[model samples]
Target: MRDSAPLTPPVLPDRPRRAARPLLAAGLGRRDAYLLTLPLAALSLLPSWLGGPPDAFLRVALPALLAVLAGAFVALLLGRWPLERVLMGLLTGLWLGLLGRVAFVLLAPGSAPIDALALCGTWIPVLLAAHVWMLGRAAGRVASQLALGAFVLVLLVCGALHPAFALNTVGNVVMQILLASLVALGGQRSGLLRLRREVREQRLGADLTGLGDSLTGLPDGRAARRWLRQASPRRLEGLAVAVITIDQFHHVEATHGEAFAGCLMAHVARALEGALGDDDTLSRLGPSELAALLRVPDDRAARAACERLRLRVASRPLDGVNVTVSMGIAVYGGEGDGLTLLAGAQDALDDVRDAGGNRARLGEARRTVVEDMTPELRSA
Candidate 1:
């Protein structure tokens, strides 16, 4: 019995956490797919050589247009599908290079090898643009811009280095430089628009996901008091407000740690939801505290209603964990004013603390009292 237990590692509890799939699954509809149209738009620069015969025109027109569309599609696909994207780059470059060779030879004889290189050069920039557009706002913007710039410099250097093809080389270099700059600028502008859209979506999601805490979502004491006046207790007879908090919740937190406290609060919130009506409005009133606005029309009925609510809560355990709730109830006495109800209700709720844990007390709503920003409340 005294054989000292082999020093054992402590067991750590796993907290229930949300899955990342939600964030990833948060996607754009057809409205968001408009970015993909960029590459297709680039196809507008088909072989429009009015000087050439119909046969010559068709020969240039078909290949060039196909090259543009295919280049963009492959690039866009590659960005989304990494392995496929690499494959697309290689295959696209090969086809474009071959096409460029043909286009160059037809337009300018073999004497201009530099012109041949320039046609081939268009492939890289087009693909880069498509990849950047496909990458959305994240990694692609920088990548696509850098690729365009690098490709331009390569063309310029190739031109400057090969003096034999000076006329062809210089003309191609200047034109390509401008084109690259435009592509780079276009990609960046699209990136900026995409970034803004992403930010807006993230902000809207945060609002929907119940991500905000009580402090931000709940109005301050003064704000709550003022809002209650709109409740119009006279028009509707009995609107009861209950303010409840877990006394010594901090003490439990000190002993069990914040994780346990959070678990407890979550459990309690669930318990509260189960005990109340579907229409009841609830908010975090203070640290480890909650407030409920119960709409019941009369005095005795309101008191009975409050009692039933209290009993439902007191009887149910917090997720099978040993914990208790202290409930404080205040009824709106046809006084629709905010401060009167809030202060009176909060004060009455406080009185139950002296009577020991697991008790509910009722009173008249106070007039024009400020609200407390508790950590527990979140948006509905």
Candidate 2:
């Protein structure tokens, strides 16, 4: 019953975590932020049409058509459909709006007139809000302040010309700007937080393959650093760090091509993985270097582990090409830190490579020799 209780808890958390992911992903996406515009546009058009002239179709159709075209232009801007081209689309749409309004006034000559100024004023706020939303952070901040200034100017002019509708216009402009700001800032913040939380949770969970190399399935250098930082204290009690590097790896890359080199690395990685024990961690520290942290009782055991790995790799044939690995081993009992320990192992590996590859050197008290360094080191 006690054994079963531990197993049951692990299994229970998996189902709930899996179910919650899709729910969070579907909430508050980029397109949902622009949905309110459709309804707002419809409401803006409807009131003017209801109290319009007998030739209401001619008066309303042009404004409605321009509004639709303007809205489509805003969508293209948001979609980032080529800046050079979308700017042209915006100019064409603006010209069409003006031409349509002029055509409506000329054709629908009537005593019960359409207030074209009121229609333009209402549509301007909606378009301004959309433009502000599409602008980048630095530009958007400036644009928002400019929009507020424009609204204030409109309010002062409209108050003198149309006192009865000025208050309504002021309210509509404020509402549209406020809505756009909330959608742009609040929606972006919430979505970013949700995405970050998801990634962090995944990092903490069982599936940690993301922390490793895609091709080799070995923990990457970042992961290696993190593990070393965490395990350095325990390593001081007695642990081994070994850095294994393939000799003349760039020559292999240049001769065989990148794809073949990648395959060879993957093959080598598998052979190294097979040599590691349950307590050992294998990591890809560089393009041609693999680092392993081994759990050992004493210095001999650490040396044995390094030799075992080196022999295992040398014996393996990758795609009919014979391969060999050189290793440098360092014990952590008398080290400054984990990084220092890794550097010591790298120094030892360099010594072996200089003496000719396919060998393992354990606990040599020397820093990395500059003359013994490869072309990559000399260039750096």
Candidate 3:
């Protein structure tokens, strides 16, 4: 028995996996980084005020004040401008400020060669590392990687040009690179986790609200009712609600199977959805009924739309079986609420079903026939 058993282990089927989220792809809006500029600008001036001449305070103070003011102005433009554009402007301003400092050091009469080189070695790496971290957090992974590579190249060139200080410069460069890599990885992981949490929360909210029908993939009745309740009176004006029911759906289901009935319902949903305008909303209201919220100019337009839907459904053949629908429309007169309008449409649907099926009716002073029953027509 043991010799007859298979030598290899059985291969199990692979389970479908969710797509992995891209690292550092979360959007960083203006609100996340707007306040960072003010503090960073103030801190950039600290070294200048501490080590420079007595008049250095006046020289650095004006530029720092200007930078803070510019950051403030950018903050005011947050909602008007795109976040990426705003971040680009801020990064440009920072680089320009660093270049100005480099020029100041180079032009000073008493400054030694070592002092200028030291300034570059210290501040260049600091500024580049800060930028790398910021870009990782705000811009994205590509930008952060680009900055990281550029800074490494610059450091390598500096080390080659100055052989005497190469040891210390190379060490500093290594430490900075490690620090930057760690910071970027940590920030990206945190951002990915936050994004995942937000997505899960949104899915939960949707499930709780029952806003979508799992079978038909259309908005469910709850969503339709919610929209009706939330819509303003001005918006509700000239709007119409039409309830559509699959004629003799129970009999069809009994004749066919439940699975076929479900497929038929989905087919009818697609047909009704295709006939609707861009502004109209289609929803599944029951097992065999769907509802449409149409934005029409008048009752005549609403009736025409319902008639078109009726014709569209009857014209299509699903699995060689003829299908027909009954529709009831209730136009909003700027008086009652959304639920009331839905109730009126439901009442009209009952009337249409009572007097034969395969027609459209308008809910008004009297149940008005928008389309007459035509049982002689068959789907091709």
- Residue-wise C-alpha lDDT for candidate 3, range 1-380, written one tens digit per residue: 00011112347999899677653365444454555455665665565557666345237645665665476556645667755555656655654554444444333445443543444345544544455355454455555456456555644554565544445543454455447555655666677668755653453233324467878867788888887787788878878999999998999999998999999999999898788886777888999999988989876677667878888888898999999998888998877888889998898888888878787777863223222323222110
For 317-370, candidate 2 gives per-residue lDDT tens digits of 887788888888887766577877888888888777777767777646522332
Residue-level error in angstroms, candidate 3, position 59: 71
Candidate 2 segments exceeding 4 Å error: 1-210, 366-380
Cα error, candidate 1, residue 267 (Å): 2.3
Cα lDDT computed for each candidate against the true fold: 0.53, 0.61, 0.66
Ranking by lDDT: 3, 2, 1
Clashing pairs in 3: none
The prediction achieving the highest lDDT against the true structure is: 3
- Give the higher-TM-score candidate: 2 or 3: 3
**Least well predicted 10-residue stretch by lDDT in candidate 3:** 1-10
TM, every model: 0.39, 0.42, 0.44
* Candidate closer to the true structure by lDDT (higher is better), 1 or 3: 3
Model 1 lDDT tens row, 35-75 = 35545444433433332333443476456656655665565
Clashing pairs in 2: none
By TM-score, the candidates rank as 3, 2, 1
